[model samples]
Target chain A: MKKKFQNSKTETVVYFICSLVGLLIVWQLAVSFTSLQKVMPSPFVVLGFIGQSLTQKIGGKILPLHILASLKRVFVGYFLACIIGIPLGILMGCSKTGKAIVKPIFELLRPIPGLAWIPLAILWFGIGETSKYFIICVSAIVSIILNAYAGASQVDQTLVGAARMLGAKPAQIFLYITLPASVPQIFAGLQVGLSSSWMAVIAAEMIRANEGAGWIITTGMESGNTVQILAGMISIGLVGLLLASLLRLIERGLCSWNIQGR
Target chain B: MSKVEVNHLTKSFGSLKVLDDISFQVNDGDFLCIVGPTGCGKTTFLNSLVKLYDIDDGEILINGEEVDLNKHSIAYIMQEYSTMSWLTVKENIQFGMKVRKFSKEKLNRKTEEVLKMVGLEKFADYYPEQLSASMLQRVSIARAFAVEPDLLLMDEPYGQLDLELRFRLEDELIRIWQETKTTIVFITHNIEEAVYMSQRIMVLTNKPTKVKEDFVNPLPLPRNVTEEKFIEMRNKVTNLIKWW
Candidate 1:
């Protein structure tokens, strides 16, 4: 069984690499043969620019430093979202009064996109780090809260009853039963929120920032450097993939029980 | 060990009566099985006894006091495998003991005992999802028995298992009951299971469920289902529960 699982994993990685290579080849061919090259750089040019950016500075900072700056902004906003959203979601799920009081206001705000909050955030906090954080928080928080609420509310009542019968206090039930049971769902929320925060950081940086992946793109566009823009996009893609994989690894460690064929 | 007395038990769901004017008593160290037809409020009745469902009009007393979980040592095995999916078998078994703040020594001792008894000692580190259906049920059983509660409530715990697995589990339960001497109030729709396990069988009628019959089982322990007396007893309870 273990051998079968290992073989399956190896096959998946092989397929993934093949698909990526296939896409790059298709992109290279299109740029070489079609009028699409008029607007965009060839895949080779973009890839070379990305490799060069590793050693050479893109703006005042290296590519990694720009990514790090965006990461810092995303981290602050995403962290704030989690601490606030998880508890609030649990409150909404666990208490009728809490839900009744908060849900209407939440519902009213939920439909508004995080990008839409930019103007208001700028007005409220100015076009500074605070504004960027606010925008990213707003973007990421909705999914976090929604997923956490779903996790908390969906806890099996039968388990609660069983806990109570086993001499669990109300607080103990919440801690031991409600909290652990909701973890997988909370992780799901975190996954989505991280992506949202990453997207928001780029958008925020695009509007006003000296250093970031978004800044790299905006600067590249100003100079008509299509290769540089593609390089920035590729970096974003790689970083996004890395962040998602990192989160999945953490989730695997924490929620080993929820995984099948473990 | 605990004696349970339920009196004037009544429950309704938005004017639809489920259990009506029910009353019964379970003596200390007795294995009492309550059998009824499907949807006859057997679960509701058990839930109400455990105070999982609020009684419209009733009183449930454990050892002469109202059934308060905090004050009473009680364990309930739900129809669904209520094993904490996030926890391993050992952790699940220790959950109740941990909640009740059992001594480290007692906790370890009891956990080991129940794990061995349920034949889940090998799977102690395994999570609920990793286990088979019967193994999951055993985890639930081990978890319940680890607490060594004064009263144990089981709601059709083996209802989902195949007959062979069910029989094996039944024998394990009997052994556990004999060794522990805990007062058990088991609820099931299977009359033969009730006859096979219980020292006393209480038959409940259809909706607006009342106690149709409550009788002692004269059949000795390590009962033979193929025997005439066992068949006679199983048939008697089956006839009472037959709706069609």
Candidate 2:
């Protein structure tokens, strides 16, 4: 059974690589052989530009530096979201009063996209890194809080009862049972929140920034440089994929028991 | 080990009463199985004993005073395998002891002993999800036994397992009980299991549950189910619980 599982996993990775290569081939062929090149750059051109931009400057900064700036923004916003949202979510799920107090306002704000806060963020914090961080934080905090609440609320009451009967005090029960039980859900929230943070940072940077991936795209658009635009977009896609994979690796470490056949 | 005295315990949800003025006593280190018809509030009775549910009337005393979990060592195994899914088998076994602040030396010793008792020492590093249903149940059993509680309340902990596995686990439970001599109040709908495992049997009536009878089992240890007296006692308890 273990061998079969490992074989399937290897097969899946191979298939994934094949599919991505096939998509790139199709994209490259469509641009080279058709009128599509009039509007879109070939995948090869975009790929070459991305490789060159790693060392060469795109907008006074190398691609790596621009990507690094965006990453730093995402890190700050995501960290703040986790520290605030996790505890708030657990409080809402664990305490009726906490839920009653925080849930309505959270629900009201939940549907408003993080980009929607860009204007207000600029107005409040003045078109600076702080405002960008605020927008990203807003974008990420919703999913973080929601998932945390779900995780905490959905904790198996039986386990809590078992813990209580085993001489776990209320605090101990919350620490050992509630917190651990909510980990997978919290991680799920973190994943979504992270994606949202990336999206928010790009948008925030697009509105007004000299450095970052979003600025690369906006600058490309202004100069009508389709290759640069495509390169920036691909860079964002690759970085987002890398970040998500990193998150999953961390989750696998913390929540190995949740994964089957491990 | 601890003595349990439940006096005139009554509980209700809205207007429907579940446990109605039920009373019972369990001596220290005694194995008592509570058997009743479905929906007869057997679980509610167990919950009340552990103060998981507030009794609308009457009291439960451990030794002499009110049952306080802080003062008394207790462990409960529910019908569901309440193994912590995040912990390995060994860690799950250590959970109760860690919560109760058992010394590290004692916790390590008890964990190893209970893991071996349940024959799960091999799967000590395995998570609950990787184990089969019976193995998961054994993890729960090991966790409960690791505490070496003054009282162990089990509500049909083996209800989900197949008969063969259930019989095997039942024998394991009996061996552990005999070795540790922990006071146990086990609730099960299985008459044969109750008769086989308990030194005394308490049969309860259907809803608005009252104790129909509480009597000692005269059967010897390492009993054979096919034995004449064993079947007689099993049938006797079955007859008492038969609502139909």
Candidate 3:
């Protein structure tokens, strides 16, 4: 089993490299040999644009600073969602009255996408960072709350009974058994919430932001520079990948006893 | 004073009556096994004793007073593996002691004692998912014993194990019971296991469960299953349990 795991790790790296190379080769060939190059620049041109944007200003701020601005909005909104949503979810899951009071409203609003909330967010908080944060928070909180509720509600009753037999009070059972049991599921919610947060940030920034990744892309489209547009998109993709990987690392660290962690 | 007495216990689930006027007593340090037919509400009876389910009538007294879980030290091992998955084997064993608020020194001592008793000292750091079925059962048993519970209730804890593993665990249970001298009320559908493990066997009727008979075991400890006396006693209990 250990050897199989090690082999799979090596295989993943090999496969990832091969697929990336395959994509770049196909892209380069399409640009060199086909009329597709009329609208789409070569991979080298886009790569050079990204390289230059690292130091040069896209909208009065360098690429890293633009990325940072968008990230700050995501972090604020995502953290707020986590703080409020997780507790509210757990409360709803563990108590009948809590579920009754909160569930209907949550379900009604659940289907509304983060981007759909943009107009309302702007109407309520205007085009400032607060509106951007509101959009991200609304988008991210849904999954965070849902996952936490599922985790808390799905706790095995048998363990709860065993804890009771071992002389645990209700509070002790919740603290020792219910809380630990719900952690893996809460992490699952966090992963989904993070992706939604990233998605919402781009849409939020696109509304009126002057110096963010979303603004860079919107401005690039206006200026008719496909290379800059592709560069901004590429940065979003890279940063999203890094955020997911970082969240996974934290999950594994906290849930080392879980099979996924192992 | 550790004696448990149940008087005319009756419990019903809405329209269905599961337990009907059951009555029994378990003396201190006595290993009492209750054998009943399948779906005879053996688990319901155990749950009622632990106050997991409220009874419709009668009373359960641990000594001279009513059974209060908070006042009495009790432990239970369910049919399913109840080891906390997020905790390592050592931590799982310590959980009950921690809940009971044992001193740090006594907690460490009891943990060491139970782990060694169950032969799980080396695998102390392994999680429940990493351990095999037999090892998980051992962890549950160790966790139950770490608190030095006054009354230990086991509801067919070995029901999931294979025959060979079941016998090994049964012996391990006997060793622990003899050492701790704790009052035990074990429920099982397996008549042979009831006869093999218990000092006294209480047989219950099929639905609306009632005690059919309670017989003291005449066979000696270190019982051999193939022995004529053991087989006779096993067959006697098996016949008493005939419902289907």
Candidate 4:
């Protein structure tokens, strides 16, 4: 049974790789057959753009600068979200008082889309990295809050009872049972935050910033540099994919004991 | 001398009284099993003593001292399969010890002792997801034992298991009880399990429950439930809970 499960996972990884390769092949073929370069740049054109960006000197108008800029915003925004979200989520899950206190405002405000915050963020923090950081942070907080809330709320009450029975203080029970169980679900939230960071970067860069991936695309559109625009989009995809895979790898390392050689 | 005592446990849940004027004392080295119908507040009474829920009026004494609700030194092995899916079997076994802050040597000794006692030595490396339900329950039992608790409280610990595994686990429980001889208060919905396992079986009345009977199991160790007297006693207790 275990062997079959392992085989199926390997099969899944292979299937995923094959599908990605197939998409790239289709993209290359489409570009080759038609005058698609003006609208849809070829994968080779995009790769070449990436190669040029990568090999260019530091702080050039290329891939590495935008990549670094985007990374910075995502890290800051996500870090801020985690700082606020985790404690509030655990508190909400653990206490009726905390839930009652925060729930009304949370429900009322949660529906406002992260993009909608752009105007207000610009007004509050101005049209700079602050506004962008605000957008990214706003986009991330709600999902992390919701996921952490769920993870904490859904923790097995029996485990808490068992912990109490086994000489664990109330705080100890929360620390041991509530925190550990919430990690997988919290990571799920982080994954969402990661992908959404791409959108946030664009929103943040909609303001005047000469040093970002979002600015690259915005500038490309003005100059009619379709290759650069396409390259920026592709880079976002690659970076998002890379970050997601990294998160999964970290989760596996943290929870390796969970499934006995997962 | 008694290891634990429950005095006039009259507990009411707002309008309804779950445990009414109930009392019992558990001696050190005693294996006291409580059995009753589903709605007899058997669990409520147990939870009340442990202060899981507030009791309307009761005093629980342990080791001749008023049992401290805040000090969770007594180990409770729950009935349901509630092992931490994130933790491996060995980690779960080590959890209570970690909480108690035992010395490394002590933790190792206790963990080894309990895992071997429960016959879960070979599967120590397995996770809860990898183990069967019965095995998961054993890990819980192992965790409780690893703490070397002053009191072991179990609520229908083997209720989910099939007959063969239940009986085998019961044998394991008996061996551990014999070796450690700590005070125990076991709660079970099954009449036969109470008869087989307990030195004394305390039965409760319907919600607003009180002690209806506290039976002393005279049956020898390595109990034979198939025997005529065993069946007779089971039937008598079965009627006690089933009938008014």
Best by DockQ: 1
Best candidate, TM-score: 1
lDDT of 1 by residue, A110-129 (tens): 99999998888889888889
Q: For each prediction, how big is the interface RMSD?
A: 0.8, 1.0, 0.7, 1.9
Residues A1-262, candidate 2: write the lDDT tens digits.
Answer: 7899899989989999999999999998998899998999888878899889889998789999999998999899889999999999999999999999999999999999989998888889998899989999999999999999999999998898888888888999898899989999998999999999988888989768999988998889999999988888888888999999898888888888897313
Q: Rate the local accuracy (lDDT) of all candidates.
A: 0.90, 0.89, 0.90, 0.81
Query: Model 4: per-residue lDDT, tens digit, B81-125?
Result: 768887878889998888888999999998888888777899888
- What's the CA error at residue B57 for candidate 1, in Å? 1.5
Give the residue spans of candidate 3 off by over 4 A.
A1-4, B162-165
Q: lDDT at B140 for candidate 4?
A: 90
For every prediction, compared with the true complex, DockQ reads 0.88, 0.78, 0.85, 0.58
DockQ ranking from best candidate downward:
1, 3, 2, 4
TM-score of chain B of 1: 0.95
Residue pairs in clash, model 2: none
Candidate 1, residue A163: lDDT? 91
Instruction: Write one digit per residue (lDDT tens) for candidate 3, span A1-262.
Output: 8899899989989998999889999999999999999999998899998899899988799999999998999999999999999998998888899999999999998999888988998899988999999999999999999999999999999999999998899999999988989999999999999999988888898879898888888899999989988998889888998998899899889899998865
Which digits, one per residue and each the tens of the lDDT, describe model 1 over residues B152-186?
89999987777886898899888878987989999
lDDT of 2 by residue, B1-244 (tens): 8999989999999999999998889999899999999989988888888887888999999998898988898888888778899989998889888877899999999988888877788999988888998888888888888887889999998887778868887888788789889898999988889999899999999989999999999999999999999999998998898887
DockQ, candidate 4, vs. native dimer = 0.58
Q: Give the winner by DockQ: 2 or 4.
A: 2
